[model samples]
Target chain A: MSSAYLAAVGEDDSRGGWRPTVDARMVRLESAVEAVLEPHRARLAGADRVTIAPDVHYPFHPSTGVVTDPAVVGAVAAWLDRELGTDLVVVGRSDDRIAFDRTASYLGYDRLAERFDAALVDLADVPTRNEYRAVDGRSVALSVPKPLVESPVIVVPSLRPTEEGTAAGAVRTLGRLVTSGADSSRASVAATQMIDPDLAVLDGTVAYGDDPVATNLLLSGSAPAVDAVATSLLGRDVDADVALSPLLSDGERPVAVENPDGVDLSGVRERLTGGRLPPSDDTHPAVSSAYRLYAAASGDAVPPQLEGR
Target chain B: MLSQFRGRLTDPKPLSIGVLGVGNIGMVHLKSALAMPGVEVLAAADAVPENRDRAERAGVDRTYDDYAALLAAEDLDAAVVALPPFLHAEAVERAAEYGIDVFVEKPLARSTEEADRMLEIAERAGIAVGVDHTLRYQPDMVGVKSAYEDGGVGHVPYASIIRLNDGPLGRPPADTAPPSWPLDPNAVGGGSLLELGVHCFDVLEWLFGELEVRDATMGRTLEIPVEDAATVLLRAPETGTTITLHCGSYQWEELPEVNTRLRLEGITGTITNRDHLPKNFYADAARAALENVASRVGGEPTVFGPTFYLRAHYDALADFCEAIRANEEPPVSGLDGRRSLALAETAYDLAAETVAEDVEVPEVRP
Candidate 1:
């Protein structure tokens, strides 16, 4: 059974709000980061180079808890630099939608990478070697990036839900990095098996539950185990998640979440249950149809935004 | 100077027009023009094929990959310059070569200097210029203006307006790739100040004549290329009203509930744009749709009638076309656009100064 460790982050700002500054947040994050990584140090100590893969899919503001906070990554890098002193690399992949460099630049990953003396790598441009793994009787192929395979990795994923209403856990974060013909869940599962990351530190410092919630918490464990814990916090069942279901099944014990700090996990779980991403700005399909019908009935010109959308 | 533009459209029965850059806003202009009486949208152009495809699906007759090629190839009375801010100057210049008038999307130009050059070209070509500063045309804003004009809010000494939206890098569940240029200072000239604040400045100036920037402050919620939020202190000397204007691209804006607030604290009572707005947007929309359908039986059509906010865009474009056909000045002239830019530039300068002032000088220990 894989047990996940949970650590509380910061107290509510007396002035009424959470996280006044990233620097101030980082100061509080360093200890929590230490607490999470302390157990994983034995696994990471042997690696010459450690790659930190974060959820850098797009340049959404960190405060919205849509993306991993750069500060959390910085604190983790600082801890590793102090404790293990391993060669560090922070990696993300650019997709057709947005460039990784652009996302990195906007989210201050460049500065964080610089301060930590870590190389920020775009996995899309990196050399890849095809790797095959079995996911539920299906042979999944992933053109796994060499850096992720070469070094022990620490995946830092934000506590949020994907547009598909599943936890955007450690598996999906890596799922986004690799090129694969398999479905997203299969790709994520294969990528996890390929990278076989040493640790995953879930940045619940801020969590997105329908909207952003400053949970002021972080959890650390193995990639799948952390995701299992995250899936539970997001009020989702592991069996429902295609990516999580396969990993958590087949005689695998349920995720054991150890909250020694006495953090209010139940309260956090309540706030985040049935949470999903905000619907796109595009007019809802039902509303659009109704509007078009209204227009046809009334002899009104269809709205430009509504026209053929 | 912009109020006195010289060119008139010789009154064609169906005003032949071309839409340049059929992106989101350009598409709105195109659709509005298509539905407009006595206006024929001949061609539309966009660099992005997806946008051109969308425009074609929206009923454009022809599409061009290059707007300049469209301007040179087609003879048009006017072109709606809805391209990116950087392209506005060049697009206008190309339209001027064909002696075509233009209705440009706002912040008119990246800077006042760029706007001056564009206006100079239009003046030399004897082509009229209109700007899409549509906030004033919104029904809620119109109601506020009507109430104020009627002196329902007597002697408003203090007024404040705030306009906010999730800019290029939109809010939450980040699904799509946001365009990079909106946050790039070199590409866009500035951030929320130009993107959103200019709209507030235009609407405020429309409400209270000739605003003067008193003091201002700008902030970035993220370490993105530009300031996502800004607050400006302004004085409308003509009305003796000191106004506070705050605009930011930081707030997550969900559709149907736009984040814009305008309030006037008068001696009699506080008047808010919110009060003027419909009590229920969906209910109001149903009413508007019903009214528009009923009107269809008797008379003229309302372009983009189903969407309440988009009516402003339709009315603004309609107003411009009307002014051009009637040989009258555009209601929102190029000078009016330039004036908004000027106010924004002043606010930026003042905000920069405040930031500099906040940086305490190190005491030299000799």
Candidate 2:
């Protein structure tokens, strides 16, 4: 059965030269996330918990030129509480300073763990970061442990793509969080999801794509589907189904749903029941599945994934 | 009939010539001028002490560290301005002011404005100003001109010239800086085209007749800021014939050969030539035909003739001297030089704009 991972970040767009509206950005993010998640809802329902990594660097609100306050975080927390129940434990990286927002902290793992009895694990504070560091003996290490591996992990990297490939944004920050959390020493995996508001919105109603920082794409309203839709609206090619292919193994394909059409959740459940289990670490190679999907969509052969133990 | 013209060959007095900037190219001209029957090198000057010492070793009796002193003392009929491009305008203007004829090197000045001023000064003084556009004097180029004028290639439609040579920096192990002219944009105007492609452009005009460049582009694909390569598209005014010229400096070998390609689609048949060396029209048709046949079979083009520069210096020098003696216009007029410079500037401007826009221009037919 396929699992759907939904991640979103809310941004404050106070600077206001040329940023998209919050709603528009949300739509784009929703489109992309839904496209990938619609086919895999059954697996998601069976998962232990859904992980969310917020934009900890720069969050702006264009309408009032204010950041996501406690009221805003409470509002989102209240919604997640109502929809996903009290089982949600939002995991974040300690290095993300922007996650320190009072509202975010209020709904953060600490507050949520007490309120809904969910565990809020900061990957940096875990022992996995040091374990991975010792194992790799390299400056840059990304990996996870077995206990955390029980729950499916969805990584949401900062969406800012640079020539050199590393930049501070929702997508990059999320990737860092996952990589840092999964390190043998810092293992805190639950399921990772990266969210950007621009991807959710279809128009230039909010901020344009610029330096991921000082922009609203990395805030709470972000989702992978929104990123794909936003990229498409800007004449860029991005497919959520293909992007999530890395999460599946050979003979086990993840289902994709195009928004504004398709069998919403009801149709997804029907497909999930009949679908086969995704290939395991033993059957599929060690290579990340997302990379395979990316290569295939780009007209290249799907190379062997990460090799087995 | 030929004997009647023999009376014109009189033993005229030798003309005194002064050699300025006794560098490599300057020395070449110096040697050639001294070898001529009615020419004498009155004085030589160079900013470098080593160059002055070398000039003295080469039998130049009067050598000076400064050019102004050399011009003052030497009773010269003509001064050869072989200095760098920046020094050309002042040196030529000063020489013309002294009522001395001047044989300045190619790219007469650093800028088109400077070249114009020099030309104006020389014309007002009634002293001839000859630029060393010696590529025209090459025997192969002469033959090419003859062939086109004689209708050997009927209805010329398109032409192209490719010149790729080892860069001036030389290769590894013997690492050297780029040639002085190209390094200093002010001295050479533009880089590869002004210093080298100027020859190709001149030859193209000579062969195809007057042509207008509908569009052109220049670029620097190397690590340097100055242009190292260029492509120009031109259309003939009379026939509306189209041509593309590609020139660059990036070959590896020391012995660089300029490649020239011409395609002429005539009413009768198409004649195409791509050769490492220049072609000659005076060769026997049977020999040319056999070479073509061998080329087809061997999958290699024929080596038609020797290059243009083999005996070009003598012919060009002779023409300049004759023009002076006969009181006639030089073979390559000043207007020709101006036109070539204008085309080069336009090509550079277009290339800059295209790069800024980051758009590729589609190849279009005239």
- Expressed as tens digits, the lDDT of each residue in A13-63 for candidate 2 is 333342233234333344334433444445355545554444432222222
TM-score of chain A of each: 0.95, 0.39
Compute DockQ for each candidate against the true complex.
0.66, 0.01
Where does model 2 sit among the CAPRI classes? incorrect
For model 1 the local lDDT of residue B96 reads 90
Per candidate, chain B TM-score? 0.94, 0.81
lDDT score, candidate 1: 0.86
Q: For residue A33, what is the lDDT in candidate 2?
A: 42
- Shift of residue B242 alpha carbon in model 2, Å: 1.2
- Highest TM-score: which candidate? 1
- Residue range B1-366, candidate 1, lDDT tens digits: 001111233455777899998877888888888877778999999999989998888888899999999999988988999998999999999899899989999879999999999999999999899999989988778888888988997998999999999898887656667887788788778999999898899999999999999999999887788899999999999989999999998888887899899999898998888987888888878887787888887866566665657878888888898788776788999999999999999999998888777677899998
